[model samples]
Target: MTSLPADDIASPTSTWDLVPATVLSTTETDGPDRPEPRPACEDVRPVIAGHRLIGACADGPRAAQLMFVSDAEGRLARAAEDGSVEPGCTLEELAGDLARSTGRQLHPENPGLRRVLLVRLDAPELPLLAALSGTGFTAVSRHGWSVVVFDGELDYWAVRTGLDETAVVLSSDGATRSFEVLLAGEDPADVTELDSADAVCVLEWGPPWQPAGGLPAGSGRTPAGQFEQDLVRLCAGGTSELQIESVASVFDLDPAETNRLRNYVGGGSTDLVLESVLQLVGLPVLAAKIAEGRREMADLEDARHYEPTAMGPALLRGMTTEPTGDGLMARYQRAVLRRPELLLALAGTEAALGLGLAGAARRGGSGARVLGTLSAALLADAAAESAYWATVRRARRGSARAVPAGLLRRFFGLPEG
Candidate 1:
């Protein structure tokens, strides 16, 4: 394995020489006409050279910056506002402008003014790929979220030989570390447990075909296979640690429980907060209770020793509307044991669920849709919480898991819903 300095990492395909670029801020700029610079919206799909730059930034110094044009409305908007379609600040021009303005060569304090990022959410838009990559903003994981370069510094663990390759990206305090493992030609099917460390891991198929997105084709997956795939993608590609931590904050989970849930979700557990809440409500016990009636419900609740709350009941009811993983409700009881707050967080479960659902909706909608339907199930759970547990109480033998996954679609919301 070779350690490479971020600045020294070469772009394998980009031929254009690195040039200076201007850095601008919407917030600091004095005029009302200024468009505030945000982390260049995560939409760019980069090629090899651009991908390398993104990886370098993620693994580079926390302060290392990449800049970009903050405009999203395109040349029409630019022309309309500035009376010209030509760029206000080209990359080279921006670099020089930034240097002169900040008086620190490039105003090391601000990174976005330097370039752009590779952050496509769906399939790659081949046409916009190069232009986006060329800007040099931070490259995103396959999931289309901004990859934050950590503050501390980076270390390399690249492997030259063939192995069941995996890349784990860890982030803390605006710092990130990546671990690239070569499994020495190990069977791709073989399970490779990630180190228990807290960092997010981005698994790469490595060597054979490093997908530009870093997520290999995951066609048909076994339960374990799916778990592994989810684990890697959730951590490496989708959502950042801070994003998940923010969701946890809505639940008022303590530092430890919040971290555990964040890492679990980062490791690819979907609907984690919701599912954990269901366990708190004793949804799975509905199946057994059907056979023994009220006696079993009492016994089961006693053993678990927890009072039902709005969260658990709501999640249970909402999930009952569709239920392939209904059996997994039993799994939550175990999780509560590991992290008691899994249930305790339910004290404010309704508020937490609402926040999570709203967060999902805020993520945006599909091409034709107006609302973000991706997380509609969470919304359904929130709306149906009042009725979910009552239905569970009336369930009979084998009835708990009876609902099909399809039923949940009614709540999935707009676009596809």
Candidate 2:
């Protein structure tokens, strides 16, 4: 078998900086590998009689199947005669002939495949049509009434019929196949010819497919809330691979959520969460900054004794005690007082502003006002700092002056300056 390219084998590293310690170790151990096989398809047949064909693979140890069904007698006859064989047909013939050849009755001498219908359209519709040929039985092309015939087993028919928008798969065996085209506004009875000697047929259709229960309300906040709850639970200590799985499992969150969370973690947002907790606990600015910074980059052992700065101590004291009342605003004020350095950091970095710290401070109270002032100071400080660095950076260029001594020497014809 051909191997996958080396690049395809690679897994992305975790971007989140604050991954649980357990996850870090486990991720290192697990690395990249192929996934395990899914469950096999069992004996499932197309749902005939409702004007649709749906079935599952019976023999294969695979999760999906192929099906072929046709209502058009002329197309069926052409498929059987030309033997040119369509791209996806596994078996094809008139319904009667197909049954006689296979020693099975598709619909017991009805001469027309009544219940089974396969949708057939031009090649351009292949992508949507191919989606139907997957794991389960579902009604497709509901408005089109059609019939289907098959020489292969029901599972094969189910898989093959799924390719209606494209040609059917033809095997090396004498059996030929063609996807039944579901014509617009064409009555099912008008298309069939009773006298055809060879044909295979089955019929099916039913309740329409419903994707997910329904869209969630208010910008889908329900799902987001659920996701947040899952994260909160996972973070509650005793964290393990199981916790990550639990977070991942809720409502089958798609790949996008996984990538988003990874980015949040990678961009040091999780470190901010930890910092938020410290601020809540009344840590002063210097103390919190040192602690938060250490949390961001320092080894675990050094994290405990981080010292609080004067601003940090004052803010923490002000927010946590006496002059403060209790409520949402109060808590926010305290958080602001305790984390002015966070504001400073935010003001200094455009990246932090995008994260919303600056906006949050503008809306806060007296403590928030302090944070706003600190943010301005930080921004100005950053501008000055950048100017200083720019000057330093250009110092060498300025120092490389066109020395008057060299020109003087040249003019005077002196050997040296």
Candidate 3:
């Protein structure tokens, strides 16, 4: 970590060292009368030292321009532009002229400027210049230009450089505060100060790879493996607070990857499972109804002199009624319990012959699918129970008639009249 004085940060200035030897004059044009000499467009040499130019443009008065240049592999790069250069000249010369014209000086203590202006020369530089505005040193555009303003005072030399999507943060003062610059838009003065600890944590999570020929696969530690191990260890037997914070720490993972990890841990087939069930099944509402019913039953059971004559029918009636516009699962359960005899009749039928109570209760699917299946099963069970009771009624009439064929037909899916 390194600390830079707040005043040390300044915008970049152009160095004219790389200006082409031959200058093209666009103002003067060849004509038949005067026979104006054809202007030579000399090839501009690349800036060799300070930074490499990634882009340029020539538009607007005096041909505004933008350029991108960088230093280290991951270190932020500087973006320089031709803010106010003399007309009709090479970018290199224009950069130098702008720096000299503005009378800006680089601090002796900060020697980050290497006196090379990366020129991305283009015609009509206004489009490029317009794009560069407000793009801080690390501001990168999809067009491949990165804008950087190194010093607030000498903003004239702020450059637009090309970049490779890499960012570097330099820190000092035990990492309490540092500067962050992007390689794509590297400007010496465009550094942003950040807390040291937080920056280090970010660096730790950056892409990791083995040094060339350093070790065989699995022979040495890897960041991904380490991260997974840490996650599992923290989640195992850890308090909710610890687990939550640990999860939050990795929030920077790409959204798609985060969802994949969450689905793996939440015991669901798909990422949509938990939310879907909560919304569709209404489990909380059903549980509340069950609680209420249990309380009601407890009161009735506590009365030792309870009479089935009056109370049983009333209880049965209460159970059979449709859910009164209440929550789905709760109403469903109440309706089923109202007709216990129906369940017993269905339990004797082939549908439930081999299924245990748990298996009989199991309902698959979600939302409408689950509701439809459960409703159908309940209807069949009730029909079976009604048929059984009807047979008993016929026997009590003393006629001992054959089971009502129509009842069997209706309940068993036989042909109907």
- In order, what lDDT does every prediction score? 0.28, 0.27, 0.28
In the range 253-325, model 2's lDDT, one tens digit per residue, is 4576544433332332232432332233222222223322332223332121112234323222222221123
* Full candidate order by lDDT, most accurate first: 3, 1, 2
Q: TM-score, each model?
A: 0.20, 0.13, 0.14
User: What does candidate 3's lDDT look like per residue over 285-327, in tens digits?
Assistant: 2211112122222243211111113332322322222222233
Model 3's lDDT to the true fold? 0.28
lDDT of 1: 0.28
- On TM-score, the leading prediction is 1
Error of 1 at 365 (Å): 79
Query: Candidate 2 — worst ten consecutive residues by lDDT sum?
Result: 18-27
